[model samples]
Target: MRAGRLRHRITFQVPGEVQDQQTGEMVSGWETVWEKVPASVEALSARDLIAAQAGQSEASGRMVIRYRAGVLPMMRILHRGDAYNIQGPPLPDPDSGLEYLTILVAKGVNDG
Candidate 1:
């Protein structure tokens, strides 16, 4: 086996309220942002073995998660040929009263 890299591009939206300067009114909408992350896996490593085993199972599994603030429509970029096990939840800005996009990634065996 050879080392592999996985690339992922994850995206999500956050709820936000904006005030109109002229009308003095409030408006709500979904803001989107994206981020790119790279992960590498070595063949025959513990991580790789685990990922392969997980992939073999038909059960649902957990994923790795990450969050970013002040960034809308969150996204991720994973490297190619690598397996990933990731997950995340929204990173909310209390002051702004908005949630951040959560990204999740996971590794599994090829079912095909």
Candidate 2:
């Protein structure tokens, strides 16, 4: 794994319950489990297709980073202030000796 490729700053956020002051309802909110994380991000070719869809401005991309525990598809990633919802399960790539976690991210969603 090249250290230079993992230069992009990213963050891992998961849904958390927060009590609404007025209604007392437990509202969903994003809690940053990890911040300022290092990752290698790349825009997938199909991202343009996702972004072109009507009534949706979301896009898709790929991120490569060192493996860590406790990250799931339910969690979303924030890169450069853009929210990306995990589209699928995390795959570990050991074929190239990178042994990195490859995550598929969809852009523009996960605001909730």
Candidate 3:
């Protein structure tokens, strides 16, 4: 990944259990594991496999982010206060000396 492309900052949030104030019961929520991580977010086209599947699933906004490790497939990407559900497992770049992570995500809902 080019360093210049990674100009935006995003957060990686994972599912966790927290006690609900109103219900006094454990509730599922997102907790940031990596915040303000530098990454490059690109709007995906149908050429990408994730975007192809997204089309069938009615996912309008499909994107791919390139960053270092600290996230997983089930986690959500919090960018500019908007949530995007990861579509599948992250693919690590195979190029030498640049161990970047490519994560596929779709906005508005979770596939689960």
For model 3, residues 32-107, the per-residue Cα lDDT tens digits are: 7888887887766655545466334534343334545556777888788778887666767677524677666778
Which is the better candidate, 1 or 3, if ranked by TM-score? 3
lDDT for every model?
Answer: 0.36, 0.81, 0.68
List runs of model 3 lying over 4 Å from the truth. Answer: 19-26, 46-67, 110-112
- Output candidate 3 Cα RMSD: 3.9
The residue-by-residue lDDT of candidate 2 on 1-112, one tens digit each, is 7889999989998899877789999898888899988999988675555654553234367888887877798999999878999876787886853468888778865787
User: Which stretches of candidate 1 lie above 4 Å from their native place?
Assistant: 1-5, 17-27, 37-112
In lDDT terms, which candidate is top?
2
Ranking by lDDT: 2, 3, 1
Q: What TM-score should be assigned to candidate 2?
A: 0.76
Q: Predicted candidate 2: what Cα RMSD to the true structure?
A: 5.0
RMSD values for the candidates in order, in angstroms, are 13.0, 5.0, 3.9
Model 3 lowest lDDT segment of ten = 54-63
Q: Candidate 2 clashing pairs?
A: none
Residue 101 accuracy (lDDT) in model 2: 89
The residue-by-residue lDDT of candidate 1 on 14-73, one tens digit each, is: 445667678988876433334342222223445544674644332222222232444322
Q: How does each model score on TM-score?
A: 0.24, 0.76, 0.70
User: What would you estimate as the lDDT of candidate 1?
Assistant: 0.36
